[model samples]
Target chain A: MNAPVLAVRNLTKLFADAARPDAMPVGVRGVSLEVARGEVVGLIGESGCGKTTLGRCIARLLDPDSGEVLVRDVPFSALKGHSLRNFRKNVQVVFQKPETCLNPRMTVAVFVREALRNFGIVANNAEARKRLVELASLVGLREAALEQYPHQLSGGERQRVAIMRALACEPELIVLDEPTSALDVSVQAQVLRTLKDLQTVVGTSFLFISHDVAVIRYMCARVLVMYLGVVVEEGPVEAVFGRPAHPYTRALLAAAPRIKPRAVDPIALRGELMLGDVRLDECPVRVRCPLAHARCVEAPPEFDLGDGHRSACWLSADTASRSVSPTAMKAAS
Target chain B: MSADAPLFQIDGLTIDSIRADRRRRIVQDVSLCVAPGQIYGLVGESGSGKSVSMMASVGLATTGLAVQAGTVRFGGVVQQAVDQRGLKQNLSHGISLLFQNAKGALSPFLATGAQVGRVLDRQAIPRADREARISELFRVVGLNHADLGGKYPHQISGGQAQRVAMACALATDPKLLIADEPTTALDVTTEREMLRFLKRLCEDRGLAIILVAHNLSLVSEYCSGLSILHAGQVVEDGDLGAIFDEPLHPYTQGLIAAVPDVDEPHELIPIAGSVWGGSADIDRCRFSHRCPFAMPRCDAGIPTGIRTRGRNVHCVLYDEAAS
Candidate 1:
């Protein structure tokens, strides 16, 4: 496999807490992943699963506590001064809520061109305006849309403007944080298609972060599932979707509301690893997993289930192959 | 109507919202029935008046929003048309509402127990009786009343908070609970637990519900009957399975097809146009432009509400059979 355009290794982000001690209860524990040019890697989990935090950390919006964020083999975290500025230009982000993300005062054209002129990506107003039009057009926004403010455009239009602004820097990576979650289901489909089209035209790698698993299933080529601020599962989207190996991933798939949930048993987790009846090393999934035994408590890091796919559970090859149906709830008593 | 009949019944309801320019009809001659122990689903996008139609029953209508004409009968008691009296006076004890946000449902200052008890206390329940009412309410919504009364809003998780909100709605021992996108704000696991708790609560003691949501898949899980709202009107209303199998209105079919399902891998066909809100073209149909099956005849005539396949559809495509 070719080396990825962006490789995040042991990417841990910890914010100092005023309430809790700095050492204990850090936000994001050791997280690791990659994004190849023209490839879309989806980050899926519930809110506070470190999806947004991870995106911010990768975009260099927030500094990591301990880990490496490599861009074109050069460490992004290692850069200082103008190099850091360059790194920022290399990776831009479109936040989850477009309404709040876009400045109410700034017109859409100004919003798109701000990044262009600031990054020195374009020399002058004429050059910046010309580039802004192209970026807007790439994301399916009209040149006339530039004259309108964020509030004037519809929810779909505003998001397209947000996407256009993200592309204005001509970044190699775009950390899209729940780009379509707020929009209506119909409008969301259009935005997703636009994102796909933009990726094809520009070959920009996206770290699309969302709490909804179904959305990532349709849009992303690869998927990464996180829990309790840790990478629980990571592999091909279809593999993780069709044959989800991780207990958490399987549970998420089962718990996800089906198109038609006639007589379907809802997936119930035992609880979060930190709060539930289990420890991190003992298997983060032990609390919720019905297949868990005493052996899971002493399991090593990531028991490979063949291929690149991996799970942290201590279940043996034979036991894992048994294929327990996740349809049954853990039965909360 | 007997008490054994549906909790809420509306034969012909027309809810309208007032814009600055003029009065515009929103929910046009809509009608549906929510029987006791039934979870009736209301599905539609924003501006579809799904929220407005249900919110009208609960007496929480937004400003510039008024039921110019709509009959809302809750617990066999008919609400007076568009007056504050219809909501607070007659159906006060009969109905309660749960908003999409649990945090918003609960006041930040008040504790969960206090909030739940507040609903009943408003109707002149003694302070001493409030404690017992709070406890029973918590049990009804599947929350531990044991010392949970003292904790403030921020102290609990979202699922627990919503459960507390459910407890609040149950405080009046309401016959009908109107939940507006209740699960929209929750995670999948938390949402599952919430719905299960609600279903079980409904099963144990009979309580009617009007669950408003955009996703039909979610509505199909629990709802026996459904009303699909579009452009501030009931485009389709009736059996959940029948509509899923054979939706009469093109808008209903489009809205149902838009939801992306986890179990079922679909191409996710999105509806063509955004909802129009200023004012209807008056003569022209609301969904005339966006509907794939729309014809030239649709632009000229106002589609009359008609029944097809046991469900009411408001569209020109179904006009031939209805006419």
Candidate 2:
């Protein structure tokens, strides 16, 4: 819609261990997605599913081996010098651990002030100080918290400072990698609210990466489910969560313990967890898919479920026609 | 109070940390009880003393921290401290602890099987049967003995390592297990699997477990009862479903509301005000500074827990209702 704030097409990144260079573990393979302006898009997957790699690639923190990244129609992957600096200013990243993301020696003010200075936005210390206070207030941090070091601050406060640093340059898109996963429920709530409030105010598009399905459902408008570097499913958050088409997505939803148990029988995924990529022709989840068949071993089809909901699975056509539940499919398989 | 006494009970447990010759009460009159085959959750934000109180219960409290006041009653016996050398054998026979980072807790030098054998060694189990017992424990925890038992802590995945740790913890056949964020390091899928296994362990073996976590939903789903800690004090503690249905404490209400519900997505209402350690120095309500419904009386003294409808809440609102 109106040229997405950020766009990725056929992104691929391979990470090979130095000792074992011949067998490269899969890291974000042929992933294509987009984040509309002011929209919160969720990237959900289990650990080592390449969600973080995808976030880092989009933030330009890591260079992808292939594919293209377009920031508001401007090519991001090929930019250099001044264009690269401008693109960096247009996007920012906040990591899971605020302690590591921030310097222990630096005060909260300096941590955020440095971001502004690096962006060349503030001219002098006075201007920087003013902006720092403003940023702190924007994230619900008190004025005095700016004087304390990261260690002196609470986990939630440190996370707020991290968010403020991301917002310091006023980027058009912010990539949040498990920002609230580290904090407690109450503190996580505060951080989540602060983020939602800030997004509303700044209208910044966010690529939220988290393994927490509930947090993703609450904070993101659109959801993308990844498995072994592949975007197995993508759809509106409610649609995907309410009626997940992909077997992996459905399994994830069922696995996550909810406040209230669902009426459907829990789909117990069979087979051991397969790490990295060994073969690319068939579906990545074929080994673990409870409903796997010969077709799954041959080809992975991306089926359109309408309303921007799509999934890669061999049972998509049959499931679509029958609208069979995950438990039913599991029982049949 | 001895009628079917809890498997493990801690009452009025106060912990103080002394630094630079100044004593600060970190945990104020904390207490909890766990019965056989029950999952008791202790939920709180970081620095809320949930971990500290737990560590104190097991006698693993860090240096400079002391249990100033409290009684730990385990298996119908009142003990001064859990880590007392005189009670080492009894403690080993009765209690087990699981940490957030199982790899760090495990000895890197020893193979996974050897570590479990060591725990068995503590129980004076004959060396001949230790191997068989280790495999049995691994099987109980859903681990392949040959594949996982031979690997070092570094070799196994985080989830597998955690299961290895669980196998070691269960080596003594302990009656109660203190699991402090035991599943925190694993992915959501792994976490669910681990938790389900733990639940089955409790039900099948009659092992009482204290599940400490910050995720309200996880605690709610798995635990039957829980204690909500705020700034080292138990703001509320009772039936998990009861608290979820009608949380009496403002802190508990805020914490519950803050959790992102997958089924019913709504705007999160984050509790205002950061919890500062220095605030604990005051004798008043620990959460008053951040409490939305705080009144002038809340700053007077620590509110005592008031029981209502099978749950206990230490807040002025409940205090008023009690009066």
The C-alpha RMSD of each candidate to the native structure, in angstroms, is 4.4, 4.2
What lDDT score goes with residue A127 in model 1?
90
Shift of residue B111 alpha carbon in model 1, Å: 3.0
Q: What is residue A259's positional error in candidate 1, in angstroms?
A: 2.0
Cα lDDT for residue A308, model 2?
A: 81
True contacts kept of 2: 0.75
Listed models, DockQ each: 0.63, 0.65
For candidate 2, the TM-score of chain A alone relative to the native chain A: 0.92
**Candidate 1 per-residue C-alpha lDDT over B185-227 given as tens digits, one digit per residue, 9 for 90 to 100:** 8888778778877787678888888888987778778887888
CA error at residue B85 for candidate 1, angstroms:
2.0
Minimal lDDT window, size 10, model 2 chain A: A324-333
Q: Tell me the deviation in Å of residue B141 in model 2.
A: 1.0
Give per-residue CA lDDT, model 1, range A205-317, as digits (tens). 99999888888888788888887577777778877888776777877887777656747563457543334334445555666776677776653355455555655555434
The DockQ of predicted model 2 stands at: 0.65
Residue pairs in clash, model 1:
none
